[model samples]
Target chain A: MKRMSMTMVIVLLLIPMALFARGVSEDVTTLTIAGRDGAYGDAMELAIQSYTAKNPNVRFELLKLSGSELMEQSVIELRGGTGAFDVILIDDPFLTQLQEAGWLADLDALYRKKGVAIDPDLVENMVNIGRYPYPNGPLYALPHVGNVALFAYRQDVSRKYGIEKFDTWSQVLDVAKKIKANEPGMAPILFRGVQGNPIVTGFLPIYWAFGADILKDGKPAFDTPEALNALEYFLELAKYAPQGVTAYQATQVSDALLSGVGAIAIEVWPGWIGNLENPELSNVVGKVKIAAHPGEVKRSSSMIGAWMVAIPKDSKNIDAAFDFLLHLTSAETQAMISEKNGVPPTRHSVHKISSLVAMYPWYPAQLDGQISGSIRPRTNYWAEIESVFGDYLQRALVGNLTAKAALEQIQRRVTEIIER
Target chain B: MRNRERAVYSSFFYIVFAPALLIILLLTTYPMVTILYDSFFRYSFVVNTRTFVGLGNYIHIVGEELFQRSLINTLVFTLVASFSEVVLGVALAFLLKRQFLGKRVASLIVIFPMIISTMVICAVWQIFYHYEIGLFNHVLTTLGMQRVGWLTDQRVALASIILVDLWQWTPFAFLIIQAGMGSIPSEIFEAAQIDGARSGQIAVKVTLPILRNQILLVLMLRTLDTFRLFDKVYALTGGGPANATQTLSFFIYREGFKFFNFGRASAASVITLVGVAFLALFYVRRLLGEEE
Candidate 1:
């Protein structure tokens, strides 16, 4: 009787194993993507739907998350070598740290294995952002989102102040003063003043324009004269900003610009002003002009904030993820996503699409910025550096510290961080 | 025979207690030991590297200005918010101790804030505290007063967060205290009344002493919860307006996750654990001494 019972248990287990083996032999592959939320999530869903329609044997699982949540989850999962995610989207500034840890699979190797070449239609500068050691190293990812920081102003407001163009930071300040004096209840200058990433991103273009750099030959440069000048200039211009501007974030700045209450925003993202031309959603349709940031001691340059997509080293479906990446970045897909979801495209061909250009009049300027924009200091310690820089910069903004004092304090803290 | 009976009892006790003991060790003791070990090294989670630093991390963080500021803010937030909530909770419990009209509805209304999600509460309060168009600012403007930066000004930001926390958590304290008040035998109050005691005397002499254990328990829970304040500050301030609302938990989060400096984060965690353990011991000792 005991022998019969053991045989029954074995038969039951064998039945399921045989069934599982049969299931595994089927021609279906499910690729998991750790993507971003909001418009990016919508765009991913559209691409998944299109891909599934063409290739019925493949399916997808998309984990749509916020930027921070995505970073935290991907780090934890990738660190464990779980093979839970096939594809992951990374912020450009953070890609280096992940690459340094060898978390991402090599796209160059995958391309060579498949006997194919990289698509040249994607903006070369954006594509270079995914390369470790920056611009001359092996490619590990592809650009998924083309984000460039741009300057925006109310053309009518500037013309009313008798200024045709902002050629420098000083010119911006003069225009801001005139707007504040003449236009009651209108904020003349706006930027994200909340501390950390928002404040640092908003301040970098100005910092760079003043011939100051975060790192000069791999050391802190905040103690330089140019950094102090840029900070003092920033504080003076901030006088014409809205009350409670220290609390302003992307939402507040974008709201002020869209409602016509802001005359000039020192920094704006393409994603934030996608609906600026829509009459129903925007109060200043056809009245706003977005362009490259103005210069100071040096020439103007925009900041590149592209999101990169890569396959994790532990992903079980690297080939599938790589194929999907190609589909996701193709010019046709980029144009479709731009029209339907308002995600800026990373391809030259997509930028020249007449329909897209008409909808987004800043496409030419965005392309120019993409070609010549500056990437944030690429380092494994970028997060720590940005955090320290932001904290002291806001201390100056709120009058807790003078510009020179803030720069000196930043120099001390950042030098310690790098040394540690 | 007595020895045999004791052995049987021991066997049953072991059988019943083993699973819970194993679970407790796995869940609590293991992580505590890991954090303690990691605190002694300069650890990087990303690079998977660790260098022995002895007490360097602890000394460095203790001397850091940001850590000092975060500690002060956390202590101020805890003392003010928890005491205010407990006081308000006791007051509301006494005022409603007697039978009143619409008692069920009143109790429900009093507990509404605690029942709602914290993120939802934060969203509502964020709108109410907006600088330009918020309800509070609009009312102030209507009364011919200048608009206040409720969240933008460093002086007012921490106070505003404390107010929100008190609003959301006072009901929790009220529920526990009211339950304690309910469990007291009515004859004690009657005896006090027959002894010529007034309402105030009875409340102080009879009711409060009887409810001491419950109050201490609630206070301990609130202290521990408020000490680990993270979500509200994260959703509302992001520790901003120049680090006005940075708490120890926020500091540790930024160090561990944002900067990936596990050694400093683990050190901060160990320090927080010791502080919380000390507070728990004080409350537990008081409760035990009262019981004896």
Candidate 2:
């Protein structure tokens, strides 16, 4: 019994010392990153490899999570103050919510401590998206994925029909009808029609093109005539989509485009069509053209959907994570990642690289979209709004609700969400 | 001397049972109590804000159209999927119970769907259910029939999901029912045959009566399992084509995880728990009554 007591005392004494050692090492050693999957994951892996090669002392624990998974985990961990993730990726819409909750480390303070300035090479507009108050608030994140909604169509098919320019929604619709008439085998229109994020994202560019806004002066704007027009036009355009359009996601849309079975997609992201020119991966090599969406009542409305990287406020290795963040967003690193992984870079110099432009052929249009594209409404309630809107929009598409009725329902629901 | 023995026995019982009893309380009772408490508040988990709303959340959620629709859809899914799966399972159990060629292989094939991953099943079914180029559509077109939207049309999407559920879970029911059937004596059937009872009549009067407890057991298990349907709906339809396939679990997921409305999610969860508790009580009472 005396020996056991002695042993227990020693174990109890060592526990605090071990905890002290961990506390000391936690701020300087391993950096845990809660990142994204797919191409973004690849890009982050490349950056981690390069960073680790330079600083052999720093280790990484990377979690490549789905978009929703990332958001949910980040919230749970950050809320609990677990310090589980040193760095996290935030979808732009959710960034506002995270920032509002003060869950992100102040990047500006980190920069001041490091005695460095924010790089001008990074797109200013994309950088501003990481701001809490949006475009003016202190920086909390850096743009990691320069995603913008882009329109894609078969150039060959358009030339064959003598439709040289897509200047308006009407022109696109006319072309879709002609293509459907001429080529029964080809689907004239394609977009992500599944409910929630996919459907909302696919419809936003068209919604903006028709001069409709999701929010105006902190109020819901779905009841406007322009919004009704946009929905009516979208429903009409959706008629030319595939029979299973309502089930179409990014994979189906991209597959349809790449296999040459789809003539036009009203909304396509830069990441989805990375292999559009790859002969081995695409059947429509050199046949498809990617550009900004066609204008309707307004100029082409490219929806910016950049993913941002930030150091969590509860992160232990904040300094190391900030350094890695800088390296990940650097021009050379962005260029290398873009080349290898087909991830769109947020840096202006990387976007302007001639080789990348040659391979992508839409870099200029993508850069233009990044510079001027309208972002989703900057509100903490965007997710709820998007969910409600997507649900109603799909109800309209499936003929359960008329366009006007859907908009009215969205208006009512969005008001409720915002008020609450 | 008797009192001393009883004291020792009682002390031993407490010593053995304390840890397990404490663990059970920590695991189940704590979270349930927390959920019940939170359901009466307005809580934003992310911002760490809580306001006592005093049944406002419950009232609001119960009145929402989406919640009503989700409740109805979940009930339909549970009832249809559970009953159909039980029926199909019994039919299959009867078919396979008789001595036949390749019995082992047939049994293996019968249980294949239950063993495979739900996501993989959903993926294969998704391709088959694809509206344009799906195998089902291709077959329909080849036979000069109009292509049906198996997953897109609201009217058909729920039915299609139910069909997939039946395909996956009927095997489980089959295994349980078959085991019960296997326990029945060969002499019972022989006596029935000798008494000039027809095959159909024997199955209905004697066999089914004997399998009543087993059938009820299978039905209860299936009902409970089907009531929590999530992953298939998440992978295949994402509670979509206009929320036609949304279950109570999916509703809570969207409210809790997606929207971070913890209070509302708690209310929905409490509602579901109450429902499941009622169902479990009904089944347990029946089973226990049978035993009695």
Candidate 3:
């Protein structure tokens, strides 16, 4: 009886083994993509739904994750030479790291192997973000999302505040102060205050507007007077900001803007502000104007935060992966995401589409922003430097440190990181 | 003939232990060795090149003021949080030892936090800690007091996280002590009461003496666990408001995962390993003394 039972257990295990073998890929099968969450994920899902209809055999396993989680997992699997993921998505901030590490398969080489040049409708500036020593370098990925930091304000309110021309940070700050005093029970300004990328990205345009470079001659120069003045200006503007602004993330800031509780959003991303014009989403429709940031000591400086798609270096199904990637970033798909879901397009031509422009008023401004926006410093120490700077900057904003002292302390630590 | 028997016994034990021992060596010892070896180099995930630096990473981490502050913050949090947990846990366990109106239900409620995941706990606590919308600030506001920046203020952020840790883990220490107390014969306590000893006298003399080993065990375990505080800081604050809550694990994670500066991360890990090892040694000594 015991021998019979043991035999039955062994057979049960073998049955499952047979079922597992049933998971074997067909000669033409599905492509698995590890992409990002939020609107980007929605955009990918929408594109996949449409693409799968035409090519019914091609199924998809789309893993939508946060930016940080996606990067960590991709690196771990790629480094371990696990070919589980066919195609992977990366934030542009990490492109420099991933591409430089040789973790991503070179797309140019892949294109040559497939005997094709590349997808053409993709905007050159957005496409260039996928390259190492970006803008004129080896292509390792394809831009999936063309995101830029833009300024948004209540257009009618700005007019009432006599802020007819928003050309400089000083003008925006002055208008914000008046709006604070005159506009009762409403936040005059709003921005992300979460540390790391949110706060740093929000502050960058203003910093650049003050002619303060995050890096100078390939080294940290945050201790300079320009950076100090920029931080002081940031603090001055924060005086008129919403209470509890220090804890604001993208969601809070957007909720405030969309609910008509705030006047100016110092920094707005296309993905978060996508439904601005939809009455279903926004309490105040067509009131907020999304455009390039008001420039100060420098010309309008927008920060580019594009999402790029690439095959891992260890991908077993490279051909299948590249197929999905091409389909994923195609003009039709880009236009569809833009029109249907407001997933911002990386391609200029897609943005220029009449139907798309009708849906998103910021498309023209977005295109201009993408073409001219500045990418964050690509140093391996960018994460560390940003954290240190963001922390001290928040301290200054919260009145824990004077702007000068904050800059001086950050300058010392930032230099040390750069030197390392 | 005696040596032959001893040799045979040793071989038999080794044969029994070999597979399990090898698993430990592979899983635990291998990672330790790797981190230790990597600490001597400048490791970059971006470059994928490792250059020998001979303590350069350690020197660099030490020179960074944030690292120093994180070390102090982690140490203070570990000592304060763990000590309070053991004391409070013992007290609660002792209080609940008797038959009460809803003893079973009360016990379940107390151990509820231990079953829940730390991430879930952090999520709940984050809502509670929010300055404007959180229940904590709301309570303060209702009482006609100024709202507090529970997670934003550098002075209070780490302590607020500590409160969350204590809440989630005091139950663990309580359960262990309760079990230890249950195993002790009730006759000892009955005899103490027969001698007309006061409740306080019996607790100080009998209950504490018996629970001493269990308390020590809880202390060691809690200390080791609390030292590796990463998730709370990650989910709640991300070690913000000026490195106030930056623990050693977070420091390593930032360097290793975020920056891919594995060498520096390895250095930080080695420093942590040494600290934990010292703690382990202290516990072992206490354990030995108690056993004797």
List ranges where model 3 is wrong by over 4 Å.
A1-26, A109-120, B1-3
Per-residue lDDT, model 2, residue A88, is 94
**Interface RMSD of each candidate, angstroms, one decimal:** 0.8, 0.9, 1.9
Q: What is candidate 2's TM-score against the reference?
A: 0.95
lDDT of 1 by residue, A1-420 (tens): 999999999999999999998887577999999999998899899888888888887899999999888988999999999999999999999999999999999999999999999989889999999999898899999998899999999999899877777889999999998887899999999999898999999999999999999999999999999999999999999899887888898889999999999989999998999989999989999999999999988999999999999999999999998999999998878888999998999999999999999999999999999989999998889999999899888889889999999999999999989988
- TM-score of the A chain in model 3: 0.92
What TM-score does each model's chain B reach against the true chain B? 0.96, 0.96, 0.98
Which digits, one per residue and each the tens of the lDDT, describe model 2 over residues B141-217? 99999999899888999999999999999999899989998999989999999999998998999888999899999
RMSD of each: 3.1, 3.9, 3.8
lDDT of 3 by residue, B1-292 (tens): 9999999999999999999999999999999999999999987766778899998989988877778988998999999999999988999998998888999999999999889998999989989987768998999999999988888887788899999999999999999999999998989989999999998998899999998889999999999999998999999888876677889999999888887889999999999999999998999799988899
Q: What does DockQ give for each predicted structure?
A: 0.74, 0.75, 0.49
- Poorest lDDT segment (10 consecutive residues) of candidate 1 chain B: B148-157
Off by over 4 Å in 1: A1-25, B1-11
Order the candidates by TM-score, highest first — what do you get? 1, 2, 3
What lDDT score belongs to each candidate, Candidate 1 first?
0.92, 0.93, 0.86
lDDT of 2 at A240: 96
lDDT of 3 by residue, A1-420 (tens): 999999999999999888777765453576778888878889989988998888787788999988878878888877777787888888887777777667788888888988988767677878888878777888988988888889999998999977765999989988988887899978999998876777899999999988998888787888878888888899899888866777788888898999999899999999888788889989879898989999888999788988888998788778777877888788888888888788788886898989778778888889888888898888667788888888888878777789999888888888877776
- Please list the residue runs of candidate 2 whose C-alpha ends up more than 4 Å from where it truly belongs after superposition: A1-28, B1-15
